[model samples]
Target: MFVLDLIPAPTLRDVADILFLTFVTYQLYVWFRETRALRVLIGLLVLGAIYSLAKMWGFFLTTRVFQILWQVLLILLLILFQSEIRQVLEKVSPLRFLRTRKRSFHGAFVKSLIRTVFELADEKTGALIVLVRNDNPDEFIHSGHTIMALPESSLIKTIFSRHTPAHDGAIILSQDYITQMGCVLPLSEKKGIPEQYGTRHRAAVGISEKTDAVCIVVSEERSEVSTVTAGEIKTWEEPEHLAKQLKDWLGITESPSVKPKEYLKLAFVKNWGAKLGALAMVSVAWLILASQQEVKIDMIAQVKHVNIPAELILGPHSAKSVSLTLSGSRNSIKALKAQGVGVYVDLERLSSGTHQILLSAKNIDLPLGISVNNVRPKSIRINLEPLKKKVR
Candidate 1:
């Protein structure tokens, strides 16, 4: 209860602030969840927590060092995570939220894609094919010939034929079209990738890591088919299984194996720890950074006289204004105003003689969570004089 009392009652603005912060934090978690950058984010948060604890515990040297290092660390992080930062900003854009028709692979296109992959796999012809998703890989694709042709097996095979010049590079498949062929892709330098995987496989993993695109790699050495999505690689032994996987990835909806409840469960329960941690981190940070600070501000409020006898008039010697020293949370202090506060002096029972009236919290009308630490002129002398009869 004591802790609760210290917490100021939340206003509409406070609620909105929490809601917006919670949303941004959750979105950040969603964006970085699949990448190694998420671990880096967790590390940054750990550093922040340490800094906050150092400050709270009055470790002056530790706090001072962290304070000095924060600016440098911020710039370093911007340089290190520029790509992740750009992707996050793109996701949050207002225009990105505007509804648009979702693109899906047609049955014919899917069949052609599967046929092309198997044909290349059988002939031991190495090929890399990129399936574009919501995130365009145009920035990563270079030196590709613009084909803009339908995703027909004959055209794809012809482009990937061993003797063809473009067969050395990758082809990009967008909605219903082969947008580009012979495009060079960035290679993944990630450790622990199998030694058996060659340049084509590395390129597949590279593009998948950089964007939301699914990559298919047909190995010339093993004559096997492999798929990379979100930096994870999977191999399919049977063409039927690969076809099903492709259909699922393309949202073709051959059959609904999972229920809607399962999807809800996946959304909420998949990374439950990360989600809860994000919420808690934002809420705690808000308390530490926004609400818990103590501040003192001086306000001058008018001294109001109440219950004075009708025959008695206040003398000029009495104080007309009081300077109040108020202490409270930063928000409370910020919201306070001189006009909203009042110092009242009751003169109902007092006689006409000069009386020293002690000014205290009871004499002041103050908002909640605010206290008058000190008042200039703790006691004001009031002299009530009898009014003389008015001459007619």
Candidate 2:
């Protein structure tokens, strides 16, 4: 039997809980990446490492201080990055009206959007398109004209034309429909915005920082295409690459044309560093936490009668098993439970009607790192009877 069988099997609810937690963690990592909160998260992990080490080394004072800090760490983080937390919560909230929608032609919409963006880039016409997701960007909608029209490449290009009246503002897209056009967005008040970035870039970053919307901008001066999401902006030179990124951000899956190996290679080459770093961090954290956790378990071990003479017939014994309490690290205890431990009694030299055999820690064979702390019925009484001679 596997070691896991020593414990109760996980239910469907447990699987669901694990999957939910994994999804949330991935989302949080994506949101925190390229943001100031990344540094805070690293610092917290460092503190956790220190606490684990202190606990393993039995440093009471240091461990106590870290434990106290851990108790208030959540509140402290909330107070320190209240704005960033609010933004993330708003993006993940289900109550946002922008997320309530029926399924439509997502593939066609993504293709049209990509085609329109590249067309505007080639013509040197500037465009800012905001793709709203969970968060409602309705506050900025009143500042512009509401189109509520189907998404099409030609229509998008005409709306963003240099001579058009709506060319100066942004167009808001909800799924496959154009919700609004000529919408003036909130400009980012964040300091240190580069002088090269015009008002459009700042506005794109502003809306992205406040919501979960993906913003695409085509620069009029350089005809460069850029995407802004989660307060970070990345410039793309190739139209295909830009299109692929937009499809990914919008969760639009393309036809399965690429081979599995080629897709894996591309994924690895894209973000291997981040993926490896996350794996290493999780491994180290698990090690530290596991090493510091101690557990005590009470188990009943059978007593084995060994080295008994053939002439002796064993009679009833006061106790056939002993209760043992073992203490060690959780891993060690689990292994011991899986493998099982037992106590032995030597009756080769005993020829008694009633005799008590004293049991101690030495009587039981235990695995390394595990120690017996308590044993019930420290001694056992054995009653032996001699075998009768057989008549010929």
Alpha-carbon TM-score of each model against the true structure? 0.66, 0.56
Q: TM-score for candidate 1, please give it.
A: 0.66
* lDDT, model 1, position 56: 68
Best by lDDT: 1
Model 2 scores what on Cα lDDT?
Answer: 0.78
lDDT of 2 by residue, 195-239 (tens): 888989999998987876899999989888899997788998877
Candidate 1 backbone overlaps, count: 0
Best-fitting candidate, scored by TM-score? 1
Error of 2 at 173 (Å): 3.8
- RMSD (Cα, Å) for all candidates, in order, is 7.9, 8.8
Lowest-lDDT window of 10 residues in candidate 1?
1-10
Q: Give the Cα-based TM-score of candidate 2 against the true structure.
A: 0.56
Writing each residue's lDDT as its tens digit, candidate 1 over 1-392 gives 64564455656887788767876788787767756677888898899889988876689999999988989989998998897788778767787779573764565688778888988899998889998877779898879898788978888888889889999899998887888999999887566688998888888888887787888999989999999997789998888888888877876765568889899999778778877776677777877766547778887888999999998899888878988899987766756652378889999998887999988899987887898899998898888988779999
